[model samples]
Target: MTSTAINFNQVAYLLITGASRGIGQRMAIETSRKFKPGSIVVLLARSASGLESTRAEILECNPHINVVTSSVDLSNASKQLLEDIIDKSLSKTPVGSFELAAIIHNVGTIGNVERKAVDMSDRQEWEEYFATNLFTVGVLNSCFLQKFRECAKKLVVNVTSKACLVPFKSMGFYCAGKAAREMYFKVLADEENDLVVLNYSPGPVDTDMTVDIQGRSNAEEIRNYFKGLRETTTILTTHQTTEKFISILEAGRFSSGDHVDYYD
Candidate 1:
């Protein structure tokens, strides 16, 4: 169906990464209800079980929703896999009118090391964070932007962290990688395209990553810092952040480059 018809029904073809759990999984569930019954939701992540569980949850929420899962590691994703996904998506829906209504890039990683920049060892650990946070998002954006340009009515939402704006002391690598992804999209937004790309800071949510950080060596210091900033800040739940994101996406006035915050 054309976007004009689909828009009325909220039948969007949404593609979300990091959909196994956390913010990505929450987005999938929220979108299923926000969009139409026949809407196609494609989820990508590294865990097959998590993907399946997410799909099941979405199905439970909306039995008629179309949920597709791809268990591929975005960090080292092959070109063939990307091509295959695009081809499969096209095959499932009608051609020339299949718009990728929305895309959420939620895949990220945080290293365990708390050493200062000068004392940091094992450069490979930093490289891993960059691969997962920056490179993977860039690759996915390249593919999605191409497809979105071919169609119309596209929206790209990136799940960034507040750490990008206010740097966390020991988590320099994570902050830097997320910042790179933000910069890449900031430039992409300036380019000529029909797609509307938005970079979002979802705020600090309760997740496995945060729990890991709390258990780290510098946990007390980090907690103290956050506690001091708590009055000026707010931690969002997965549902709240995802809901706000979907509202912005549905508003359809999204510009090319805009940094949005869930807490604000």
Candidate 2:
């Protein structure tokens, strides 16, 4: 892996999706503290109240930082709608006002983990899954690039998963979505040499999603695997995983587009 120096102190425009709770909320608040005063932080999610809670916490951390929260349903949003949301969020602060522009694509769905691969015959189901996990990501990244093209440094982060490489039975939708999303960012990195793109796998953190998987996965082995992590007290807390994530961003090492894990 290669290392590059990133100045975290610079004024920045940071946008994070799925910022209502879990890793996204934690990351949004933690990363906000690292920015200079007058920096902008845009939080997007379906839950309006949750985003407000995140915004409140961010303001509490640094009242000087500008925080904008928008409720967006990524699952069914049209490309034009996504672009409009981006425009509305970015309009809170002037365009050429930041030295660094970064977006963390943390929004996603687990899909129907109860259904196995052979049962996944509905094209609508697949399209909905890809809409949230893949299509919106590409649309948002393209809009971000165009809006912040003048920034001195650009960072794009895809919150990827180990499932992207390793298959998990009964998790066909989730695994496939993650795999496609990861490759999407890798290609983005290849095409945009000046951008710093990272596919970060935050490991099995103790979140509601993990709890859902533990109880809901159709595969007994998969359920047991997550249950074991919880039982052993090995599942990482949101704060713990966010600490590692922040360190990785601050360090700015690892070649762009490399799939870096929390353990790594």
Candidate 3:
């Protein structure tokens, strides 16, 4: 939980997934602007084009910041494939050369199939949700710790969902994955001391994904809930929420396994 002043002058790096849009993209840009000049940021996403656009925005904010883009479909990628990508990316500039400051698991999904357990076609949607939302965080956190165990200021911020704490009817799989993700990080916190883990729920921010969330579900309760968030303007935009997220990251004050919301 305790952290002293970070030496921004030192070479540092941040790895963030889902960086093509939403809070992930804003996090990259704002973090880069605050990091030491020439610090490196690795952006991971499924969209090469979106990653490029994010990189451009980041550089526009801090011209000296270095940006690396990795376009891979995490949903279907094997562990070896993910490991290879991490290996090559680290080798490009050497993890030892910089302090691996942060790893933000901002990638998650509500699943393409929006249905309750009883209505599910099979385990396909549940499995897919777990793969992207729950599985990847554990694997990437493991890989990151293996490579940067010596980084004294290592931080892991998992972009979780409040849905983990509360249940949603049609988003059963998503809720399950997020709940699993929270517990996974909590246990990891007990097992590791070299890094600080924060399970963060960004709340229901208005994004491209949320817009589509309106009618994709079979349940009227779930559909109306999402639609109301939009119609009533109850949601915060990604930019509006990034400040609080950055504050948490920069504060470096939370204990490992701390679960916090955006307003918290």
Error of 1 at 87 (Å): 2.0
In order, the Cα lDDT scores of the candidates are 0.73, 0.88, 0.78
lDDT of 3 at 159: 88
68-125: candidate 1 lDDT, tens digit per residue: 8888987788666776786686565764454346778888887663666666677787
What is the per-residue lDDT of model 3 for residues 1-264, given as tens digits with 9 covering 90 to 100? 445223344567888999999889887887777776647788999999999999998888778767889998877777677677767766666566676477889998777536567876777766777778877778877887777777667777888888889987777777778888899899888787666788888888987777666758767877788788888988888877887776776675677878889878
List candidate 1 segments past 4 Å from native. 1-9, 217-219, 225-234, 252-254
- Write down the TM-score for model 3: 0.91
Q: C-alpha displacement of 45 in model 1, angstroms?
A: 1.1
RMSD each, Å: 3.7, 1.6, 2.2
User: Which ranking of candidates, highest TM-score first?
Assistant: 2, 3, 1
Those runs of model 2 whose alpha carbons end farther than 4 Å from true positions after fitting are 1-3
TM-score of every candidate relative to the true structure:
0.87, 0.96, 0.91
lDDT of 3: 0.78
Candidate 2 on 1-264: residue-level lDDT in tens? 223445668788999999999999999999898889878899999999999999999999888888988898988777788677768766767777888889999997888989999999999999989988998888888988988887778889999999999999989999999999999899988887788998989999999898888889999999999989989999999999889988887787788888999998
- 2 versus 3: better lDDT goes to: 2
